[model samples]
Target: MKHTKVKDLLKSTTTLQEVNAKGWVRTFRNNQFIALNDGSTLNNIQCVVDFENTPDEILKRITTGAAVSVTGELVESKGAGQTYEIQVKKIEILGDSDPDKFPMQPKKHSLEFLRENAHLRVRTNAFGAIMRVRSVLAFAVHSYFQKKGFVYVNTPVITGADAEGAGEMFQVTSLPMDKLPKNEEGAIDYKKDFFGKHTNLTVSGQLEAETYAMALGQVYTFGPTFRAENSNTSRHLAEFWMIEPEVAFNDLNDNMDLAEDFIQYVIKYTMDKCGDDLKFLEGRLLEEEKSKPQAERSELALLDKLNFVLENNFKRVSYTEAIDILRNSTPNKKKKFNYIINEWGADLQSEHERFLVEKHFKCPVILFDYPANIKAFYMRLNEDGKTVRAMDILFPGIGEIVGGSQREERYDVLVEKMKVLGIDEEELSWYLDTRRFGSAVHSGFGLGFERLVLFVTGMTNIRDVIPFPRTPGNAEF
Candidate 1:
């Protein structure tokens, strides 16, 4: 008999007589009921077995994480939890999980312990819910752009250009590290490496995506991006997925509009499609927050928080205005901020961003028109000569969910800015050509895909959201 997926079986309006189901056993209760899940849905279909008729040998194999196939009659369940269940006629153990050796037992485990076994962590209810939400959100991201007539662009993972010029990039080389070839000046000769010049895993696809956007008019790139930064904070990851969208003839306002709509669309899509998983995660968050003080607990539930973002408009504030608000705020006044906001040019830290999003605005906030010296060189310089048309969308929990700006379109001004920033002009001549030839106003932003997942899944640590996270001093499978 053909196997019916757990998701479909649970959604069936009428129960069938003889249905085959295959899945891992989540738990065996009372030696009669087997909770089975096949990763199709968060809910498990209760499989009732006749313990008296079943042999002891077959019944003993029904341990957690064991794979099994059951031939049964799907019927309206009399059980309290599930609406439908399988009355097993025959069961076969495809694979057995030794309860003593299985790391994930039927009990609550610490997040750190689960992370160590990330390879098998998805089998857990929490991780399963998270990964499902992540998958749904990923599809939402693609669907949202595709429906908008945006071309999906595949940018190179390896590139010679440093989009941010941050110097913190994972260098890609094929030369022997122990016996690296040296030049006449005694410097390591990158000419002997792959690509005949220094190249690294791309930090951002924005630059290459811009090349396509110039011709395609509107395009977005969703792919893995590498950053060599060693920060081991909960928010930073060495390797992560990035979503970058570049559109031609867009100014700062258009960029903000695109970002706001894009985020809300994806979030709403995930919430709608993965309601079961989201509800589970919301309950999980509520339970986790119970240990904290009442005042520190979340004011709104996860679903409410998500809905609130979708319902309200993001508060748009200039960098200058944000600075004044921060300086006058209680945290800054009490010298509680780690990086105190003293002047306009001071970059906003996570503390400042959270305060604006969670405390003052009580909604997502868009901070724009940042100081040119503080923002990237590619950001469009405003007429004031001091600030750039940069924007960052700050979420309640996730500080900066999206960072983008109106690109500097003028050739001479861009070159001068690059020179002042000490960025090599010759290496980026290919990028500058877009501006040189026929550049109109263009803008884009890079959203950390994992952060979005973290927000949607209601997970605190960024590592928990991404599978097999690569953090500082940790690359375990």
Candidate 2:
């Protein structure tokens, strides 16, 4: 018999005569009721077992985390929490779980504990909801780009170029580390590596995506990217996903518009499709926030915060203006910010970003025209000779949700910038070809996919948003 998903079974209008439901046993209460979940939804299906007729051995095996198949009549539940439940006629234990050994029992478990059991964490209500929302958000990302006539491009996972110029990439090599090959200068010989050159996991697909955008007019890449940074903060992940969209003939302003619209569209889509999951996450967040002081808690609920973003336009401020605002703000005045904004060229930290979004602007913000020295070499240099056409979209809770800029289309200017920055001209000759051949004014931005997921799910830690988070010293599955 085909087993029905818990999500579909719960939405059934008419009572079915017999239905097969297969799920992991969340709890077996009073030896009669079974709370079964199959990860189709956050809600569990209550399977009432015939404990009197069932053998003691079979009943005893129905433990938490046990995989069970229940053949039952679908009927209106007498339970208060749920409407429909299964009246079990037959039950089979597909996989037995020892109650004494199962880590995830039917109780509240700390997120830290669940992180250790990352493989089994999704079985919990909170993680299940988060994953579902994440799946929908991913779909929404592709949907938004596809509907707008954007071609989805798969950029290479391994590349010799560091797109972000951060130089914090995980090196991909097949050469034996024990018997390392050395050059005449005693440096490691990368020419003998698998790719016949130094290569690493891509940090961003923006540079590659730009090449496709130059020809295809519009292109976007959604793929995994790696960073070898050692920071073990809530926001930093060694491995994460990035969404980079490159478009032709778009300037800094156009890029900002595209980013704002794209983000709002995806957020609205997730809210529409994952209503139940979002509600669960919102409740989870509220419950978790109970331990915090009123001042530290979020002012708006999860749903309300999402709705607020959709209703209002993100406030746009120049970087110079933002620096002035930060320098005169309460935090800087009271020495609250860890990295105080003392001057114009200072990079804005998370605290400064939060103040602009949550305190000063009281909405999402777009800070543009950053100092050229601080931004990447690919960004278009402004006429002021000091700033570049770079922009960062700042959210209330998440500091920089999206970072992008109008790319430098002039080949001469790009080469000069690369020369000054000591970037290899020969190494990125292919990227420069986009400018060499028919480089029209183009723009693109990269949205850290995990950051978007973090904001939408209201998850504080970036690790929780992505499955199998790879941090500095921890790579446990």
Candidate 3:
């Protein structure tokens, strides 16, 4: 009989099940024991091989990470550490990896060291857990939206304009960076650039997704977004994935409802399918946060706040109200914020965001009608004249996981906002045409996909969630 996976066999304590297994030897110890893993999980299994019963030549060839096929009798070992192990009956070497040249040995590596080797980092348990959780979350996102009848739309990677209106954009080029066409201002003429006229990788797909949602009623785009920001923080990456869903006839409140439901469903799905992985991440986060008790264990801290959000209905606060709460709060003294959180006008920073979700409301906070001046140009202007129908869904550990707004479906208002923001109407003529033809009231939000993975898996760093991180100054992988 072919041996089953060691991890699977360990789950069942059945005796005398003959199995065949093929995997890399994780650790060979005490002359007769082999610790093996088959890219299953963080925990590998210990298989006790009786050398006297095996071919000496095969035994001699078996080295750490050497691929071997093993025929074994499953035994519920009366062992001290592991519950069950494979009793080897036969062994055959499939391939041998040179232990010296290979980066990974049985020895442990620092996370910083592993960061240097992002390519092969997936072989490690933490990365495996992260990758698996990321995969499951991506599925959950698609499944959640698809089941709700949201059409999937693939947005462009390279585009003529930046979506976020954020200036940080990576230049796309068919020509070499050094040998680019220059004009009178000694600037490379971007008209000759790929796709022409200063095109760069997209920063968000919300605007494009809106074009479809106006027609399709409900649509979403899940894909890569790029930025050229040089800040090397744990959470910021040059290239990241975002899930932006736009829904026609949806107001800001409806958008929040969708956001909350989407978040809850994703969390529940992750917890259900990747419980072991989640637990692993939980433990991992606990370890990671130990050094920053103030940051981790603050009143409106990440873990506690996320657990609260995951378990309960989110609290709603108007941005104006949130600002008032922050201004009048005792906790504001501790935040040491440069910007005043006095009233309805300020952009909520991480500190103010933490205050509302973690400290003030002590629940997930959906604050709406952010100042029109501070918000993106596409947001619908509220009756108050100062605010736009933009909402940010902020959680405890993470600040704003989602940013969305009800779009000004009216052509004139949208055109005016775009003009005020100095967004070129000539470039966005197609977008304006949607309003001219069949534009309807629609709202959408951009959920930083890495942020969700970070929140769900308890991963703190943006680098930890992505397989091959593309932070500024580093695209090695």
In lDDT terms, which candidate is top? 2
TM-score of 1: 0.98
Residue-by-residue lDDT tens digits, candidate 1, 1-477: 999999999999887678999999999999999999999999999999999999999999999999999999999999797889999999999999999999989899999999899999999999999999999889999999999999999999998878687548988899998899999999999888889999899888888888889999999999999889879788889999999999999999999999999999999989889998999999999999998899678777899889978999999999999999999999898998898888778878888998999999988999999999888899999999999999999988768999999999899999999998888989888899999888989999989999999888888899999989998888886
Per lDDT, what order, best first? Answer: 2, 1, 3
Per-residue lDDT of model 2, residues 279-345, tens digit only = 9899989998899999789988899989979998999999999999999988799998899778899
Tens-digit per-residue lDDT, 12-113, candidate 3 = 757787778878887887669888877666667677888876777777777876888888777877678777778887777899877777676767787778
Clashing pairs in 3: 2-19, 2-20, 3-19, 3-20, 300-358, 302-397
C-alpha lDDT of all candidate models, in order: 0.92, 0.93, 0.81
- Model 3: residues >4 Å from true position, as ranges? 1-7, 12-15, 55-57, 80-83, 105-108, 176-179, 182-194, 291-306, 333-344
lDDT of 2 at 438: 85
Model 3: weakest 10-residue lDDT segment is: 296-305
| Pairs clashing within candidate 1 | none
- Per-candidate clash tally: 0, 0, 6
Give candidates' CA RMSD values in order: 1.2, 1.1, 2.6
Candidate with more favorable, higher lDDT: 2 or 3: 2
State how far residue 162 of model 3 sits from its true place (Å): 2.0
